[model samples]
Target chain A: MKNTIETSDRPVTITIPEPEYPLHTLSVLVNNKPGVLARIAQVFSRRGYNIESLVVSPAAEMDFSRMTIGARGEESGLDQIKAQCNKLIDVISCYDHTDDAVVSKELALVKISVGASSRGEALQIAEHFGCKTLDLAPESLVFMVTGDSGKLDAMVGMMQKFGIVELVRTGKVVMTRGNGLT
Target chain B: MNAEPRDGAQTLLKCLEAGGIEVMFGYSGGAALPIFDALETAGTKIKFVLARHEQGATHMADGYARATGKPACVLVTSGPGAGNTITGIMTAHMDSVPMVIISGQQVTWMLGKDAFQEADIFGITMPIVKHSYLVKDAADIPRVTKEAIYLATSGRPGPVLIDMPKNISQGPCDAPLDAEIDLPGYNPEKAYEIDSKDVEAVAAALAKSERPLILAGHGAMLAHAGPELKELAETARIPVCNTLLGKGIFDETHELALGMLGMHGTAYANKAVCEADLIFNIGSRFDDRIIGQPDKFGKNATIIHVDIDPSEMGKMIQPDLKIVGDAKVVLAELNKHIKALPTESWLATLDGYKKRFPLSYKIQGGLKMQHVLDVWDRLTESNSIVATDVGQHQMWSAQFNKSKAPWNWISSGGAGTMGFGFPAAIGAQLGRPDDVVIAVVGDGGFQMTLCELATAVLQKLPLKILVLNNHFLGMVRQWQELFFDNRTSGVDLEGNPDFVKLAEAYGAKGFQIKRPADIEKVLTRALEYTDGPCLINCEVVKEDNVFPMIPAGAALEDMITEKPKHRMEKPTGST
Candidate 1:
C-alpha cells in the first residue's frame, strides 16, 4: 500500500511542535459509580492526551465525584477531549482550569536523607516553603507540604539539592472562588 | 408492574419491549440460556433470528439498523461470542449506525476471575461502544436496558452494549418496569435543536457565492434529510455530490446530482469539489478519501459543515462556518429561508465536466464488473437496497449502481470490513421484507462469512446475491500492479470454492454468467427466483482497475481519470 503514491503526496500536512503545547488542567465532575474513573481516563488516553496527575474525591454531593486531572497536549486536542468526556453518561461536567480564575492545592510528602548538620538547613527551607514536619528518623526527615503545582515544583526543586529519599503527591484539587463550577 | 416476582431475564424482555425493539438476532449459549428460556415462556412481541456465527448476527443487526433507521438488537454469549462482535460493532460505530448489543456474561462472582467463558467484554468494547453497562444487580436491568436503547437511537446514533451476567439474569428482582431514565449527563436530543441564525448565515453564504456545491454523507441518510436535501438543492440551485454511504440521499437521476465525490468517485464530482467557490458539507464527516490534499482541498472554497457530532468538526477539514444540528432540521430550516441562487453558469461548467469525463470503462475484452452492476441496477430499477462488499466491485458499484431511495445503500464504510455484505443483506431483507435486497460480493470477500447462508435460507429470505468472481483480490492486485511493480503476492484465489455449488448446498438456487450475453439472462432469471436466497457467479475480467482514483493523499486535481497507457502485463491464463 505504501508504494502506491509518491512521498510528497501523503496527507502529512500539519506538524506543530509538541513543546509549544503546555500542560492543561481539567476538573471533571462525574457520577460516583464503579469504573467511572477508568472510563474518564480512557477517553483522554484514547485521544493521545496523557494525564500527568489525577485527583478523585467526593464532590459537593455524595452521588458525584470530582476528578482533577493534569492533562498535557495541544490545545485543540484538549478541547476535543473535554467534549468527549462530557459526552460520557457518567460525566456531568468538565472544565480546563489551566486558564480559569481559580485556586488549586496539592499535598506532597517528601522524605530526604539529611546529615545531622544539614538537618537544620533542610528544616529552615521547609519552614520557609510553608511545609509541616511530619516525621524525623535518625538520618532522614519527612516534610508534608501543601500549595499550588508551581509552588510545589519550586519547593521540590529546593529539596532536590538535598538527598531526597522518596516522594508522594496527591492530585491538584481545584475550586473557583466566586461561582464557576468545574 | 406485574407485582408477581419476575426473574431478571423476564425483566430485561419487558424493558426491551418498552424500548420498542421488535426483533433481535442471536445465538444461544450457556450464559445466554437463562434469557433463551425466558423468551420461550415470555417475549410475545419479540422475534429472534438465530445466526450461525456471532459476527454474522452483529452484522445482521447492523444491517437492520441501517435499513430501517431504527436501533437494532444483537444477543451473544460471553468470551468468544462477545469478542467476535468487535469488528461489526466498530463498523457500526464508524458509520454511526444505531444498534444495541447484548452479550451474556459469566456469573457475577466469576467475573474477572478468568472463569469459564468469561472475557472483560465491557472493557474490550469501551472504545467502540457509544455507551456500555455491566449489570451488577438484577434490579439495574430495567434502567440499563432503557438507557441503552435511548442512547443507541439518540443524536449521532451508534452501538451500545449491555453485559448481562448469568447470575443477574437468573436471579429474581422486584424492580419497576417503568424505570425513568436517570441520565444527568446525556442530552442527545439537544443537538437536534437548530438555531435560525446559522440558517441565515448559510443562506447568506449561498447567496454570495457564484459556484457552490453540496456534499452529502451517511449522516444525512440516517437523519432522513432526503426531502429537505432535495428541497435545499433545488431552492439554492446547488449541484450535489455524495459519499458512498450518501448514495441514495438524492435521486441519482436528478440533474443537480453529481453522483458521488472523493476517491473512486466520478471525475466530474471531484473536479467540481476542487473548483467550487463554496462547499456545504451536510451530515458528512470530511473523510481522508474525500479530501485528497488536506492543504489544497477547499483552499479556494468557503467550507460550511453541518453535523450532529461536534468531535467531527475539527477532526478533519475545519469549516469556516460550522453548524451542529440534525441534518433534516438544518436543511429544512435552510429550505424555509433560502431562495434560488445564481448557479446557471456554474451548473453549465459542471455539465461540461460530466460530459467530458464521465464514469466510463471498456468492457470489450471480457465481462467486466462495471457492466454487471449496470445491468443489475437497470434490472432492479435502482429502487432496491444494494449492499456491496469491499474491493474493486465495491467501488464499481458505487460508480454505477445509482440509488433512488433513502437508506437503501448499505456498505461498511470507514471500517470497510469484508464479509459484511451477505449478512447485512439478509438483515436488510428481513427489515424491509417487501423491498428488493441484493448483495454484490467479490469472490475474495464472499467466502469470509458464507456460513450465514443457512441463517438466510432457513428463514426463506428473498436475497439476490451476485458473486463477482474476478479470481483475485482485485483492489490490492490493482495497487500492486500500479505501485508494487506488479508483484502480486497473496491475492490469488486458487482454492476458491464454486459459489454456485455452495449456495445450492445451503438450499438456495444458483446460476452462472460466463459471457457478456449471459449477464441479463442470468440476472433476470436470478431476480425472478422468489423461493429463497439466490446467487449468480459472474466470472468477470480479472485485471480491471477502477478509474477516477485520487492516489492516496494526492490532491483532488491530480486524480487519474483513466487507465495509463503503460500498464503491467495481465497474468497468463486469466479471464
Candidate 2:
C-alpha cells in the first residue's frame, strides 16, 4: 500500500480476482459481410481454443448475422476472446450466454444401416426420440431429429450400437426465453 | 464500355489527400498501375518517396509515424512487393506505430487463381495488422479509408493493411468522396474513461507498500505519459526502470530513474526490481525479454497493471489490480488523489546498488562499441532521434546513447528486425526535419537494408549512419562464444563492401574510425555533414558480449554483472 510521505494512518491492498468457468457459450453479432467467419475463427484459434461447435444464421435484421460459439475455457481466456472479437470492425457485439436463461436446440440427420434383427430395435429407438423418418430402405434408414443438444446426444449415443453410417448435426443455437436478446 | 469509368483510383488519392497525409513511401508495379496513374494526375498534395524495395518503404513509414506521432502511409504492388513488407509491418505492429499500407492486388476475378503478380496479402497481414479490408467494391473506398486511418492512429495504434484488387482501383465506380464512419464494435473512447475509485485504489497501493517501483514500457511513450509520470514519480518518490521499448518515456538522468530492466538491463535496475514490494507497470506489456521468468517476475510484489487494451490485462503476469485505461489519463487521475510515499530508505538502498554495480566498460578494450557510442553521445549533446538495428551495437547504443526527448528513440524492439535502422533513420529525418537522426547499425545488419541509401541520398536527409563494423554477426557470435563453447559459424562477413566508399558511392559523406582516438573526431565530422546523409563505419572489437545479462528465461535475481576474466570460467549458458 502506498501511503503519503507525511501520512501513515491508512493503507490499501489491491486484488482483482478472476474466476474460472468450465464452459463458455458466446453469442456474437456481426455485419453480414464476407470473411466474418474467418475473422472470428482467428480470435479463437490464436488462443488455442477449438470452437467445439459453431452455428451462424441471419439475424432479425437483414444486414446483421448472429453466431453462437461453444468452447471450453477459463474466465480470463473467455473474456479475452470476447474482447478481441469486439475489437473487430465487423463485429457489433459479443456476449457470454453461459449464465443466461435460454432455449437452445440442435438438429441432426442420422443415417444408419441396420441388420434385419436390429431393424425393429432401431425404429423403436427412433420413435421414442420422436425422430421423423426421412428415408427407409431394406437395410438402411435416415432419420431427422430436433431437440436440445443433450437429448440429441443421448439419442445418438443409443443409436451408435446400430452402426450409424453417417451423422451430421447443427451446432447449438440459443435464444433467450423471455424478452431479451441471446 | 459503360457510360463512365467508376474511377475508384482517383477517389482513393482524393481521400488520402483529405486525410492530411503529406508523404508516402512505395514501389510501383503491375497491379498498382492504376493508383500510380491516379497519383501522377491527382497527387498535388502528397509527396511520394520512391523506395527501391517494399520492405524499406514500410520501415521508412514506420519511422516517420513514430517520429511524428501520426499515421504514416505506404503503397506497394501485389505479390512479392506486398510479401517483402511483412517484416516491416510486423515490426511496426509490435511497437504500436500507426501506419496504413495500401497494397495492389490482381483483378477480383483472378484472385485465388494464382494469377501473375498476385498474393493473399489480406490474409498474410491479418495477425499483424490492427485491421484489414479486401475492399472489393470501389464505393466503399472513402468510408474504408477514413475508418482505416481512425483505427490505425487511435487507441493502441498499429499498422492497418488495405489490399486493393486491380478491378476495384482501376474500374469505374461512383462512390461519393465524403462519407461518415461507423464501427459499432470498436470503442476507442473507452480507453479514456477512468473511474475515480480506480485511481483511489492505485493511491492506496502507493501508500501501503514499504518499497515501490514504476516499471515503464513503450506504451508509456505512446500515451505521452512523461510529464504525468514525472509529476507522480516526484510526488510519490518511486524509482523507475523502463523496458527496452520504454527507453525514452522518462528522462534517464533523473534521480529516480533506474536505467532499464530485464535481459541486458542495468544490474542496479534488475537488483531493484527483485527487492521491490509493489510494482506499478504502465503501458508496457511484460514481454519475455523484459520479464524472463513470468511467475517469478514481481513475485514478491503486488502488481498494478495499466494498459489501454483490456485483453492485455491477465495475458502475462496476473495483476493484483488491473486498471484498463490510457496510462496518461490514468496516471493523471491517480496523481490527483494519491499522496506521496515516504521512500527515502528505498531510494537510498537502490542508490547503493547503482553505486556498487554501475554500467561500465573497459576503457582499454580495442575499439569498443561502447567507446564509439559514448563518444558520440558526448560529442553531440543535442537530443537526436536514434533508430537502431538489432545487434551488439543496438544494445550498446540503448545503454550509452542517452536522449531526453519522449519518443526520440526508435528501434525494432519486439521484432528485433535488422535492416531497420538506416531506412528508419531516413523516415525519422523526413518527419522531423529540424532534429538530427542517427541510425546505429551493425556491419552485418547494415547490409540488409543498405539499398535505401539511394532513397536517403535523393532526400538529402541529414541522417548520421553509425555502423559498428566488427566483421561478424557479433551478437550471435557472442552467444556462440558464451553459451555454445565458442564454435561460431556462418557469421563471418569476409567480403563486406567497404562501407565508407559505399556511402560515398550513394552520394553521401562517409567516415571511418579505426582507433579509440578517432571515434570522437570521425563522429563529429559525420554530424557536421549537413549537405546529405552520412555513414560512419566504426570498426570495433569482435567477440564482445553484452554484460549485466539475465540470460534468456532467467529470473532478474540471477543476472550476471560482469564477464569472466577467464573465458572458460563463464557461467554455462542455458541450452
Model 1: per-residue Cα lDDT at residue B150: 91
- Chain B TM-score, all predictions listed: 0.97, 0.97
| Backbone N/Cα/C clashes per model | 0, 15
Model 2 reproduced share of reference interface contacts? 0.59
Candidate 2, DockQ score (0 to 1): 0.42
Candidate 2 lands at a TM-score of 0.93
| Candidate 2 CAPRI category | acceptable
lDDT tens readout by residue for model 1, B435-480: 8899989998888889999998998998899999999999999888
Predict model 1's lDDT versus the native: 0.87
lDDT of each model, Cα atoms only?
Answer: 0.87, 0.86
TM-score for each of the candidates: 0.95, 0.93
Q: Which ten residues in a row have the lowest lDDT in candidate 1 chain B?
A: B566-575
Superposing all C-alpha atoms, what RMSD in Å does each candidate have to the true structure? 7.0, 9.8
Candidate 2 per-residue lDDT over residues B1-575, each given as its tens digit: 33334487878888887887778899999999998898886645788999889999999999998788877789999999999999999999888899999999999999999999899999888788888989998989999998888988889999999899999999876777778986776888989989888889888988999899999988888899999999988988999999888887888888999988888988888888899999999998888888878878999999999999877887778999989999999998898876678899999999999899887898796899988888877877738899999988888888888757686888898899989988888899999999889999998878999999999999988899988999999988887787667889888999998999999999989888989988777887887889998899888887688988887877889788776554544433332
